[model samples]
Target: MHDRFARSEWFRNDRFGLFMHWGAYAVPARGEWVRSYEHIGTDDYQQYVDAFRPDSFDADAWADAAARAGMKYAVLTAKHHDGFCLFDSELTDYSTMHNGFGVDVVAEFLRAFRARGIRVGLYYSLVDWHHPDFPVAGDPYHPDRDKPTAEGIDGHEPDFDRYLDYLHGQVRELCTNYGDLDLLWFDFSYGDLKGEAWRATELVRMVRELQPNVLIDNRLEGSGGEKGSIITAHPSEYAGDFASPEQVIPVRGLADETGEPIPWEACITLNNHWGYHAFDHDWKPAKLVVRTLVECVSKGGNLLLNVGPDARGRFPEKAVEILREVGDWLADNGESVYGAGAAELPKPEWGRYTERDGTIYAHVLEERVGPVALDEIDQESIASVRLVRDGAALGMAKAWMAEGNPGLALVPIGPDEAFSYPLPDPVDTVLAITRRSAPEG
Candidate 1:
């Protein structure tokens, strides 16, 4: 195991977390990338900065929602690609403190989440569009990228070194001011702007010096679309502590060249956008969210589900409802997720498998016609089988119907040897299977 993996032991065990994408973009309610996507100039975008006051913003409420949803940790956007800082930074006047929103959003978030015993993390964007030194012309995802010169956006003679200093300074502030961050989520790296372009080694060294135990994402060397050198045998100094796969889950969890499992977390949005989009009502149901969380754990990965709060600084009613429903399911079946990882057994046709210690949790996503087949599991090795929701014991025996299949370990759905259609929990009916103890020498 890599030295960093030891530091990420807690992270690996934390199967689910909340990713908050709240920022000035929330004011527009279009999306987090509204400025760049709409090609809105800084002068036009200033409207959001001026109107950015989340009167109903309650950090405690946010933390409460996260806690109720079974989230063990959370990551909030301290600064996004638009160059707006949610915290009070002495180095820049373009922060929440200077923009009439007197509250230090980052500080409140940290205090509230920490009070609730949830590990806190901050997301800082490497690409700053509002900074004059940050090149705009010819830069993809920049509002003024199509302009003639790199300085066309702000025309300040583009000094990238100056921008680097500011970037490093802000990071230093975050590390110093925040009590103790559990993680630091960097936005991305693309084209020629990776690794040394951000002086990643020095930055990582500073972060480590300030907060030794904090976990970092691989975006300093790669983006959400790329896994970076962390997956290789020899990773760079800034290869990060874990691979962050965004928007989509990996078919199989991340692994190195040696086929050994590596730490990873999938960041997925609840709706179509990371920031609140009033028009995008296409929300993922609680069932899909629950199954996705199970899938990630079954593949030896964590899920950092996103919640984009609206401009009013409130979680959407639908989002809250879905989270509550997911929390309800977890309230009963959390044992199958928390501290669980990929089981030694193969993925079942009916559902997924997650194991911890001698216990294997079978997540029955689909209903079986007969008795639920425990494929590849030997009947002799089984110690006990019981429903995770309730401690009700489930009988394990070879049914008369399965006379031809002698090797298959079958567990009845209820009292009888046959399955009762429409599972008690349709989303995920978890069954805890305990392995028999080994014989003494």
Candidate 2:
């Protein structure tokens, strides 16, 4: 029997999640984007390992904050390109618990998140730099020195087979220790090598066998059938549990070919930097975060906003503050986001739409010089329009329908002289347009 992830209640209902990328690497405060970009030597990179002492590392606090921010699940880096494990794994001595911070991070997070009634997802990177057996490291596409090089593999002092054994052992420990996980978010694939493919498939199978409810990502499969071949190639066209749209948040109110708008989550960072950077103090404003969430939800996608805790294992004050602000916004109008589908816009460009039940939440992001034009929305579906900020009726029942189409007469309601906060809210206020029926001509 095929285990369909898209149909899973845990995934569809949870349209907002959190992604934590804290590790020994964050100690340097450079950025996690360095593993591939920076031409730093192994000795220098390893220095961060020694300095990775997270005195304030509190997994419960992180999980609690995530739950407060309306997040349903959290994905943490179990193992990154540096081959560092966040848990107590016998596979490698370069784990968080053994390295310096003697704490089982993954286990701690899992327990705390589960306690808060939130699902936990593990982010495991297939590209291991410490492993002598891991191939395709020196390739132009992937230039991480931590990844195994061809020459290093051939003249390896430590046995390659032994490394693979250790890797599998750690995987076993993670699955076995975590009771039951919601997702295994795998990153990077070593082409179609027999060994790599075999290990990936075996891992998926093993995880599922242990926890039948566990979900897997697209990285489990290679281009064509090789060792790692459980999922289909070209995941966007094919099927999967959730569409992991990285970095770039789509223009508002767009969808994939599946017609279901493709169950997606935009994994973005607080700053432009994914990891903590000393020089990068340009933290995104709380308003921008709210806008990002609103935009993602409007497109029927989840927002997995990322945060890189410092070496002390605590989120930056700026990040925390913004998250709290986002939480406050969600507390009031989350109905427009959670479990909502991409709503149909009247003109398809004036604004974006997100729907739940019979309500259509319109997000007007663009500033219009004249009156907001639209090709008359299906008024039969609309019940009433109200501002989400203060629940004020828009009084657009008759005005909603124009000559040719239903155009919006945006009378700025705030106390501003020019335009009242552009549709009357301090920040970006969602218009909760309640509808009576589904959209139809």
Candidate 3:
């Protein structure tokens, strides 16, 4: 049997990526779901589209920021739920080509990120409120679902099959027009709009044919909250390649019925909102971002962090600063993150444990009073212990404090087996533990 997660090899290794949510919604300076949240009519929302002019947009700058943030991949919102196309879609006149500064945003993004060796992906929202054939009244997330006629949409009999054709056609355009995509992130499936309601199987088949190696998220069969059959013994045809958990990380990561690890990623925003909100100053600190990334890596999952660019196509200054700080930290301790997964040992009391190639990375998030106990690790198996940031050798000894527990293996943080209060790297002081090789037969 083919490995269901074979295509996710790169994704697993990457472990960190950038997710950009930019479109006409950026013009409003509100979140991406502003229309649905505030019940804004199509006519009122069209004004932002008319005013959308990202003249200061520089794709290279965006790519540079991601690279500096140590992100190995990126995904841009080609067509968000608002149905505004960032790419040059021949099928639609309501795109950047017709509305915004006439630049093919998706194409530029792909080129810039690809140039920087960042694997590029596009986020296509399955829910398009602008499309006439798409159901409005009685639909779950539509702005005018309660009163379709009230939202500047002329009341008419909607043909969902026609909408599916358009959706499929646009997906095809994305697959064909883009040279080689590494991922295709679908927005969602909620209420009764999931599975065949969007002709998901057919759409997935077409995508697979066009981009065989592209990693697809589970949204085709599930949403952010629902993981779908991807975590089951037998997944559906449209089960997708990876579980996409949004906003929150999985408590224990994801696994199949057989206990095999399932490929998963946590899509988290740098701030509270996905789209650029001028007043949303609630940005996550660089320390939290770094620790969050380490947590994801330790759980055998990737972290696709988001940055919502403002209307002028510039990433918020604070976002850039935070990313730079994260990059600075990654520079010294990237070995503990990239290609690292959950260690065979249990979670350490100090922090988490990630392993790669028999080397255990003890991410010391807290400072312990005595020699940090390397629980569940045998003293004979330990070859060497060193700090990941500076490669300073840390002494391993059975400190007198742990005399009561002779079986415990401890690594002292200070001279004479004394424990230090403040760790060298306060955010995450990673200790690299190399396991001794087995005797030759």
Report clashes for each candidate as comma-separated counts.
Answer: 0, 7, 0
> lDDT values of the candidates?
0.91, 0.67, 0.89
Error of 1 at 392 (Å): 0.7
Tens digit per residue, CA lDDT, model 2, 331-357 = 877887777766665424645677787
Clashing pairs in 2: 129-146, 129-147, 197-227, 197-228, 198-227, 376-405, 376-406
Tens digits of lDDT, candidate 1, 182-210: 99999879998999999999999999999
Sorted on TM-score, highest at the top, how do the candidates line up?
1, 3, 2
lDDT of 2: 0.67
Mark the regions of model 1 whose C-alpha exceeds 4 Å error after superposition: 148-150
Error of 3 at 341 (Å): 0.6
Task: Please report how far candidate 1 places residue 225 from its true position, in Å.
Answer: 2.4
Better of 2 and 3 by TM-score: 3
Candidate closer to the true structure by lDDT (higher is better), 2 or 3: 3
Question: How does candidate 3 score on lDDT?
Answer: 0.89
Ten consecutive residues with minimal summed lDDT in candidate 2? 222-231
